[model samples]
Target: MLRAMRYLDYAATTPVLPEVTDAMVAVLTGDFGNPSSVHAYGRAAREIVEDARDRVASAVGASPAEIVFTAGGTEADNLAIKGATRKLRGNGNHVITTAFEHHAVLDTVEWLGHDEFETTVLPVGPDGLVDPAAVAAAVRPSTILVSIMAVNNEIGTAQPLAEIARAVKGANPSTLVHTDAVQMLGNLPVNVHELGLDFAAFSAHKFGGPKGVGFLFARSHAPVEALLHGGGHEGGLRSGTLNVPGLAGLGVAAEIAAKEVDHKIERVGGLRTRLWQGIEDSIERVRLNGHPTERVPGTLNVSFEGADGETLLLLFDAAGIACSAGSACQSGAIDPSHVLLAIGVPREIAKGSVRFSLGRESTDEDVDAVLEVLPGIVESARRVG
Candidate 1:
């Protein structure tokens, strides 16, 4: 029997590839040991954790000593933002970031602000890109950290990280620059050194690995305090017992992703362009969000005027086409995406936006299926409502 539908929500999460699953399963069934114990079994598990760290670090142009694993992207972001901000509290209390950042970063900064730190959320341009000059202007003498995302989850806009890092460092070399690279890790080329960032966050599931594992890359010189207090683990920055199976899966996924990134980019970019072209040719009253050329290769966000995003999503779901209204983390909420609002999209249009994110498993047939079904769904939604 033929499958009824297709999934295009790679931005939310990806299914674990067979190889990644096998790697994790081996650890789960064969060498199940608590990495914190002093026994030989624990040592075996700890070795797997360390090996995964090296793979993840090498994929991002960092050393194994710099990688710290966490539960996932949210924990990694919280630890990087809250830990760095609190550690630098003695030096300063102000922080700067973009308004278009994922809620993980935005909410974390807001919570930090409530805790007595000052925060400046810089506005993005119409293209959803932040100006380095604006970032520099927002930095106060008391600013201790600058947190920006490598890619906007809603619109797939890629930030000028290298430039922003340079601007922040030039303004105050002591002001650490951190980027949420969770969405960018598999879709784009990421080198922490080339970006000039002091710290960065990444999640394994975003790149075909297990869901429970992620890592933060903190430069050797960057000062950061631990978010969790427990048995000394992850160099005291994160203290929970390591997830051995998840770590093994992450290691295999990282190595595979690093080797295939260039080819994936080329293939996914072509698929995205094809999908966009079909939408442009068939759909009316549609608008594309984010910088057309500066966005991620496999993400296409568009708004259909006068259509409700949630309704369209349901219709698409019935048709077996899977996508998202915005960031999956924030999808259940009623409010429109803050990212679209930051880019100056009207509230009504923003409420109608849909994000189609491609992945390695997507194909021309999948794109064609969506192109065939989406226009009718939009038209039907417009007519009924």
Candidate 2:
């Protein structure tokens, strides 16, 4: 009998929900119009875009006016970090971020440091947690922007955004706080006020919406310079015509996620626990990465000892299990996870890391499928590797 395919990579991206697809189809076909135009068709398209803006804003506890749509989370991160850094250069050149932030923020900050900006990347402990006190110490009079991720994309560790924000604010009230919250919007509780965030980035595709659609939440007081020089769209923070269909789908997806968040967390968390327990019972020397209790519900990055990471992934694939070795953004990277190394995992051990991210569609049978196949897959990998 052929093994059934089991997908467990929600952190990378999610399939669009039926409702979201329906909304997207309507906008793409019947409601298609230029949002910038003054005509009737344009007005209709513009309304859809604004409505999506509102939906995303409400989900994050921010005002609609604060939401600026971007092409995706990467663009949102670029806008938040680069835009803010450019605007605040005269005030200060120093910025602070975590060592394990996604490349979007990491590379952007590094690039900024190449010329006009000074940056400080803080370290995370074995638990993949950034200390709030460290952030406080890093804050300087010249610190202009502090960027951190709400959740680590590789291990799914939830950073203490609220505590980190408080630290940054306590150190310097003038410093702006930006968080890459692409992984938190649908998977965890996201409230800008509660987290005290000056800026945040969210990707719709991470939450069962269309790809290539995301937004940045900028506080009214925190103004970022434009990344693109064009018709001055998106409050001059970003330029170019809006993605009406993608935005419409994103709005619907956000609304659905908001309404179903509580149940999804509880259910997905239960599934994660079941998976962890199963793996612990079935395998020896398998270390769990990320925080013990502070992680989101759907993510589990495990390092399988005595098994080659690449070979193990192939074995799992042969068994019809779909997962990841690192962030989907680095789909074919051969290097060990930078996240694992940052958290103090040895290079040899990091090479065995594999991430299994559950999602809304996951069920008990999916978890069982992992339990059934993983042990044999590990044995096969160890034999060959």
Candidate 3:
């Protein structure tokens, strides 16, 4: 009902909640201060940041001392991969990750490869689940870090992190296990210790908080070197002046998400299933992407044969239904999705896929509207293609 279009791209970024916005506004106007300064204002700002860190940590079963705030998920991913690799330079120049990782992890590993480091990209099965055995087999004697995302952003596929972490640690006790948990934070239970991960990344905007705020969870024993060099902030692991207002919003959002995730999951999961069932009942020559049941409850990705994703997206837009061709960052590209291809989808169908992500705010009426609009859009796109 917004601008006559129904939004279905919550995975890309969520709208900030009114409570989170109010918290941020209070900080921006009333408690504005540089955390590094030596004054009452500075102390107040520092206290806010610290309390926010504690809330975020509690949400993920981490300690406040282990959380290092960053600009966003991408920066957190870069810091964890690059910083951990740099710290273990003497141990080896080898790292291991999955083929289906987001570009942040994939690109960082590619950059490391350019620097003479050997990287092994493990393959996922057609189910889009990485096998723990594959990771254990890929680990070389020189392997120093194993990084994997807790959930796939494109398809909402959940990786077996607990199994993967145990395998990595068993193969090489010194090797660090890092997971990008940005998409999994609000949708799933993310206990770092329970998952046996050394480091993990999260972003606020993914969970109805303000953007440009994220955190990296680093275990005490698996400390990474500072990626940014200045100001000695975040225990010298990430150095820069803190975003006080954004941090406050993040804290409020995290607490709200933690308290409401279970109920939200049930509601959104039902909506996602209704959408998927509607599509399946109406459409033909369509394939669902990712694992059948082992995915985030709020996301559904589907590939329609003989259709162009970009064309279908436009058709749906014209009909007042908002969806995505693929990842927001890669929307302009014409090539097939690497994530879809990794899961063994045909290139042509991959080119015709769209991701529909639901959120806590989605209603049954919104779900029905999409069901009414999408089949015709897909039919039209296929005929045109």
Candidate 4:
């Protein structure tokens, strides 16, 4: 007999909610048409895409016209940084970001350095939180843009976005602010104006929607240049034929997430607390990573001394538990997580880290299940070490 499978990697990706998948079937089966065509079939498809745009925009507290749909979070990030920075290059070469940002932002900033633009990677304190004062101090009159993530993917630390935005504007009003909010959109309340962000990127799959569909929120006042050039779709910013079925699914998911966010947060947060307690009660030489109180409720990263994270993850997999050693993006990479290193976690501890992320469907039993076997898993790994 098989042990019950437990999924603890919601942050990496979530299975599509049943309602969202059901909603997509209509578009997939019959309503499919090219959104750009001028015919009646196309017009109908256009409406579905538009409705999806509205739902997604409402979730983020932005207007639909400001939403530029892209392939996924990475594409959206590329568009926001490269497109926005392209227009600002004449003003200054400097752009500011944190050391713990996802590679989408980190690699993009570094690529800019290869050209005319310069990059400044700010440091985070031991709490895995960025200091607003550091942002204010780093702002140069030449600084044209600042891109920070609303949440760290690996460590799950929530940044002081509002505080940091104020620092950026207070230091240099000309600088535009952007955030990689893919991890934050459905999990937290996101308002572009309220959050003081000029640009934001999100992935649909991160919020129980289908993958390969995401959007960019570019404030009307802070326009981004077109990353792709062709049919001038998406207000001429991100030109591509719309994915009607994917949009429909994404819209439904966003609507559900927005309507049920508070309740889900409370539920998942409670389960996460239990999971943390379970591990602490059973495991020794383990330390929690990330901000203790200022993190998203669904995610917890922990380090086990004297054990290999890779081995622990493999053991967990064999025990019918799904978890992560670090960011899903870094899967198959042997190096310790950059987020852990930036937060001053020693290399040895970082090497043994594992991340557990809960979701709306997660239950108390799942927490208990992991708790039941984790001690053995850790002990087995340590003995082999």
Model 3, 1-385: lDDT tens digits are 2577788999999989999999999998899999888899999999999999999999999998899999999999999999988988988999998888989999999999998899999889998999998898888889989999999999998998999999988888888899989998889888899999999999999999998999999987675898899989998898889999999999999988888888888889999998999999999998999998998888899999999998988888888877887788788775799999998999988999999999978889888998898778888999998
Estimate TM-scores for all models.
Answer: 0.98, 0.98, 0.98, 0.98
> Which tens-of-lDDT digit does each residue in 1-385 have in candidate 4?
7567899999999889998898799989988789899898899999999999999999989999889899889999999899988987788889999999999999999999998887899999998988999999999999989999999899889998999999999999999999999899768877888988899999989989999999899998685798899999988897888888898999998888888888877889899888898888888899999988898989999999999899999999998899999899998785799999999999988999999999988988888888888999999988876
Q: Write the per-residue lDDT of candidate 1 for residues 200-260, one digit (tens) a residue.
A: 9999999999998899999986799998999989888999788899999999998888888
Q: After superposition, how far is residue 102 of candidate 4 from its true place, in Å?
A: 0.5
Worst 10 residues of 3 by lDDT: 1-10
Model 2, range 261-341, lDDT digits (tens) per residue? 889899999999999999999999899999989998899999988778888877788888889998988877657888899
What is the TM-score of candidate 2?
0.98
How many pairs in model 3 have backbone atoms within 3 A of each other, for residues 3 or more apart or on separate chains, i.e. clashes?
0
lDDT of 1: 0.90
Flag regions of model 1 displaced more than 4 Å: 1-3
Q: Quote model 3's TM-score.
A: 0.98
